[model samples]
Structures are given as structure tokens and as C-alpha cells.
Target: MTITETSDGSITIVALCGTIDSSTAPELHKSPAIADTLRSVVIDLEKVDFLDSSGLGALVGTLRLKQEAKAAVLLSCMNPRVRKVFDITGTVKLFHIFDDTSAAVEYAATHNEG
Candidate 1:
């Protein structure tokens, strides 16, 4: 799995690519960069091809962390398969999802500004 982070003052976008499974979930969960950021987190899943239960757990854990910090975390650009998984698991309702990078950024900006 690959994770990239970009921030524009008020929001932090974390773009994820490749598969997120049991083998790689720990690495993502332990990222200090993600843990330390207080701004809202927008997870871009456009390039992610596969996700397993471990990945789902990691996401849920991350969401909990964000809640604890009083920060927002959004999931964006999820492909059909990924979206299906989230839907079946009823996790889609737990996050604010966007269709693209621009939309996610705009949503974050507007929410943060208000």
C-alpha cells in the first residue's frame, strides 16, 4: 500500500493506492503523520484496487481516532468495489464521501471555513 499526504492549511488529504490488507494495514495504522494531523482528513481511495477486512478495520479505527481528536475524516473517490464493501458493511453512513479530489477539497474547505 502507498499513502501520500497533502495539506492546504485547514484540511489534510491522504491519498491511498494499491491494496490495503492484513499485511499492510498495520503500516497505515501506525503512520505518525496521520496520527498527528489535527485537521480534517480526506482519504482518497480512487487508486485503491482492493481492500480486505483488515483495511476496513483500519479505516474504522482511523475514524475513531479522528472523532477522539474532534477532527473530521472523509472518504473520497472510492471505486465501485470499494464502495460496495463500505455499503455492505454499512460504513458508508459513517463518513462523508465525495466523488473526486476537487469535490472533497471543496467540501473540506467550505466546512472548515464555516
Candidate 2:
């Protein structure tokens, strides 16, 4: 799996590609980019091909971390494959999900910080 980070002002967008399973979830957890985000963060799973329970756990944990830091964590998930993990785990409702990157970024811009 690969993770790339980009910024729209203080809004940090983390884009993921490849599968996120038990083996790869730890890399995501250890990524320093998440901590580098300031007011807002968005996980863009546009290129993610797969997600499992462990992957779902990683996302939830990350979200909780951001929330504890008073930072908004949005998700841009258009892939049905990745969506299914969140849906099946009943975690989709826990986040603000956008169909595309621009919408997610807009949400972070308007709702996240001052």
C-alpha cells in the first residue's frame, strides 16, 4: 500500500492506493503525515482497491485521534469496494463522507477551522 499527502491550506488530504488490510494497516498507523495535519484531515480512498476489518479499525482509530485533537477528519470515498468495509462495519455513519476530493476539501475548508 502507498500513502500520499497533499495540502489545501491547513486541510491535509491523505490519498491511499492499493489494499489496506491487516498487513498494511500498521503502516498507515505509523505514518507521520497524519500527525502533521493541523485543523483538518481528509482520507481520500479514490485509488484504494480493498479494505478489511483491520483497515477499518485503522481508519476509526485515526478518526478518533483527529477528533481528540479537535481536528475534523473527512473521507472521500467513491469506491464501492472501500465503502463496503465502512458500511458493513456500521462505521460509515461516523464520518463525513464525500463522493469526490473537491467536495471533501470544500467541507474541510468551510467547516473545519477558522
Candidate 3:
């Protein structure tokens, strides 16, 4: 996976491309700038085509981790199949989800502290 970031004040937008599976989950967890300390985080999964159990685990862990540090995690553009995984596992309710990155970014900006 290729993870690119865009910074808007304290809100960090992480755009993830390619598949998020077991092999990539660890990489995402250890990504340089996507720390749990950020006050606002928008994880753009628009380009992510697939997300497996491990991938879901990583995301769940991220939300919890960031929240512990007083950060809010928002997910954006989860494709239907990948989204189904979240829905099936009841993890969809755990995050603030949006249909696109723009909304996520906007929401984070308004609701979070820089």
C-alpha cells in the first residue's frame, strides 16, 4: 500500500492506495506521520480496493489508539465490499465514516482542535 498524507492544521488526511491486508496492516500501523497523537485524523480509503480481517483489525486498533490519545478517527470512501466487512463485524459504528475525503476533512476541521 501507498500511504500519502495531507496536513490541514492539526487534521491529518491519510490517503491509502492498493489493498489493505495482513502484510500491509503492520505498515499502516507503523506509518510515520499517522500517529495516535494527532487531534484529528481522516483515513481515506477511497483507493483501497480490499480490506481483510487483519486490515480491519489495524483500523480498529488505530481508532482506539488515537482516541486514547484524544484524537478522533474518521474513515472515508470505503468501497462497498470493504465496507461490508466493517458492517458485518459491527465496526462501522466505531468510526465517523463519510462517503468521501472532502467531507471527512471538513468534519475534522470543524470539530477538532489544531
Clashes of each: 0, 0, 0
Candidate 2 per-residue lDDT, tens place, 23-85, comes to 999998666767643447888999999888898888888888777777888899659878887
- The Cα error of candidate 2 at residue 26, in Å, is 1.0
Cα deviation of 30 in candidate 3 (Å)? 2.2
Against the true structure, candidate 1 reaches a TM-score of: 0.89
Reference-based TM-score of each model:
0.89, 0.90, 0.90
* Prediction 3 global C-alpha lDDT: 0.83
Show pairs that collide, candidate 3: none
lDDT of 2 at 62: 81
Model 1 whole-model lDDT (C-alpha atoms): 0.83
Candidate 1 C-alpha lDDT tens digits along 8-112: 667778889999999998877666546864667788999999999999999998888777777777889999999999999999888889998778877877774
